[model samples]
Target: MPQSAVDSPDLRLTLRVRAMRREARDVLSLELDDPAGGLLPPWEPGAHIDLRFANGVERQYSLCSDPADRTAWRVAILAESPSRGGSRYVHQTLRVGDLVTVSAPINHFALTPAAEYVFVAGGIGITPILPMLAEATRRGIPWRLAYLGSLAERMAFLDLPQLAGGDTLLVRGDLDTRLDLTAWIGSPTEQTGVYACGPERMLDALEQLSLDWPRGALHVERFQAKTFGESQGADTFEVVASRSDLVVSVDRGCSILEMLENAGIGVPSSCLEGVCGTCETAVIDGAPEHRDSILTPDERESNETMMICVSRSLGDRLVLDI
Candidate 1:
């Protein structure tokens, strides 16, 4: 389980962009370092930092640099075509020597201990896997990577010697070669773990393919909002804030976060689309119509938490630990 958002370190560092280089077509990698030459907070393989822009737009990007590098942090951003200003701002407005506010590293997609590992990545998804590969190599754990991209020229970090070895398979969409998901993800064993990060469709396909695999053996990180299945219909629901002794009515079209904000209640949120776990709230009572992609199957089954930004009460009322 992940640590509560409330307990997260209040680390807001203003780091200067030491360098910015194009890793691939439309993808830029930024190396941020402390202006005072201070050591930055430590981060693990799958951890991501929230990049807060001057325009109040915050976006999460995975830490792609080596974890042992305490003096600097690296992140790669792909200029999204129809971006909501986050990626475009980073690509156009951000530059070397510019100071940017960044939150401490958070890991909702943490890498767990395993004997053997198989990593699958698509396009910019390879950012998070880069560090994981480094960790695996350092630990001497057997691992393989299947990196898929639309084109060879647009693939980032392919020139790196670590990814150029035989253990890595570079699959280009423009080419006739296809990645055999079944062959790579064969019958799962308790000792083996599979980690994948990619587009929604790819993650969905992998999720379907790994249905019979051991629980917790397969882990994934999605770059986009997940598609929700048929729900019990968007009926109005009541939410009670246990500590504040407040009750708010949420309309069918309104989200709990929206309603709370309207009532002057503060809730921390990022990527209100439910991909980021920032707005996860404790559920004290009532069944929540889980819509977020951050929670695991077991976590959802436990009904201990819900992403209030996109989730709603399954029943008429929900009791929250807020």
Candidate 2:
């Protein structure tokens, strides 16, 4: 499948897997390097790639390795309980030397500059946080972490030098009574950033706990789509895909992405429910009724981009940068 970039829409690379190793019990980390020993695109902490497997399954994985290392990119995959073709394929079928397709890194959960940071991670959610720790250390920023998992052996990269290098890391299993969010997170300050990525239950708890915190103090990324409400009452809208100069009417039941695809405009998309940021498109004109699970409230207010798969035009018509 073709992928779209914010700057270059038609950016996709076929990278060869250099190494695949078991990081935890069921967690496997894959190291992808350029096929011809060339440097890959530069990425910052918390950036992720839309990895398209040969089995025709595409999934998003966070770039967990040090961002300074541009020669190779590393991502850890968890073998979920119920097989979602992507993780299962990576665990069972994918080989070390096999070539795989990936999109340019896209980051919605970027490590913002802050006076300090509080990182909370659960299970496989630690992938993105692993890199942010290094970045924070390099920048000489004070930070603390509370890494939670069901079992010690289930957490990937617990032995990373960064984790060992810090005394503020509180890596604990679910049974550990000392994993107190109240004491660990404390009260948020104006310049302190609280970043978390995990299962819905943990994120939901963090969301409820951080309600009184600053508007943009806490950042979280979900592995699946949140509980989205019913369709909007004003569902019918016209979309002007400006790059292709195509206009189409999207009806009550249909989505902008569906309409665009039917019009022969193949925009890269996955998890059409709006969790993955794959179909995020630039908004040229008009306000979008943002519904994606990725963007923050600040981002939605900015109205710069929208996940066309699920979001609609707030007004009668919208001009999109296709």
Candidate 3:
């Protein structure tokens, strides 16, 4: 079957499991193959695919392989009780040759050139960081990887240390001590870029520490997003999708994007909580609330940018060029 629209428009891709491994107690490295073609769509670092299940549940997982590797895309799934069912399905029911529909890789977090890069990863978060480490290594970019795992035995990648070469720093929390990210991310110089992916607490700490650094110096990808502040704080507004000639009420409980979608207006979106830039649209009029994490304050102030995922309008209404 084709991995895209002709076969399944909803997800746009498919993964026929080629290999699997017991990375940890509850984590597994699943190597997925292209459905029919030689390779899948090209992607960059920090890209992710939305995995769809037979039961109709869809969840996103970050691509764990180097984007340059077109043969297959790798992802690590960790089973958790509160899982919305995506990880549980992959960890338990998914088999070596089973086919799973996946979406084209979409990237919101991308690597930028830095004199020095420090990657802080915790447990399953290490998957995405592995690709970046490989890219850095290939380019001879000076970098350091601080990986924290529950135990040496439970660390997913057995080849992690070897892959990172001499720049790798593995911290086994089950053995020595809990990691102090502040000591690792220290005073950020102009040329340094700090990239981290892990638990919410780790991300929060990184965010707080990054406040003192340059605006774009710290790059982060959180699997779970901090929710957008409710629209009650927003002024009740209207949005006119000029092209559609649709006027939608941007109410206190409804976002402009939600209103549009509810009205059967389709706007490309992923990670609707505001981290991914998929729902970004051009604002023709009215000041935007700028609730998304992807855009800078300056970009938001320009009114040329808007993240429909969470941001709403400031005044009576907004006129979007969409």
Per-candidate Cα lDDT values, in order, are: 0.85, 0.86, 0.76
In terms of TM-score, how similar is model 3 to the real structure? 0.89
Candidates 1 and 3 compared by TM-score, better number: 1
Residues 167-235 of candidate 2 have per-residue lDDT tens digits of 455566655665768777889989999999999988888888888898888899888888767865367
- What's the TM-score of each model vs. the native? 0.93, 0.91, 0.89
| Model 2 regions lying over 4 Å from their true place | 1-10
* Ordering by lDDT: 2, 1, 3
**Considering only N, C-alpha and C atoms within 3 Å, which residue pairs clash in candidate 3?**
none
Q: Give the TM-score of candidate 1.
A: 0.93
Residue-level lDDT for 311 in candidate 1: 88
What TM value does model 2 have? 0.91
| Model 3, global lDDT | 0.76
Please, what are the lDDT tens digits per residue for candidate 1 over residues 107-150? 88888999988899999999999999888888888888999998
lDDT of 1 at 169: 82
- Highest TM-score model number: 1
* Weakest 10 consecutive residues of candidate 2 by summed lDDT: 1-10
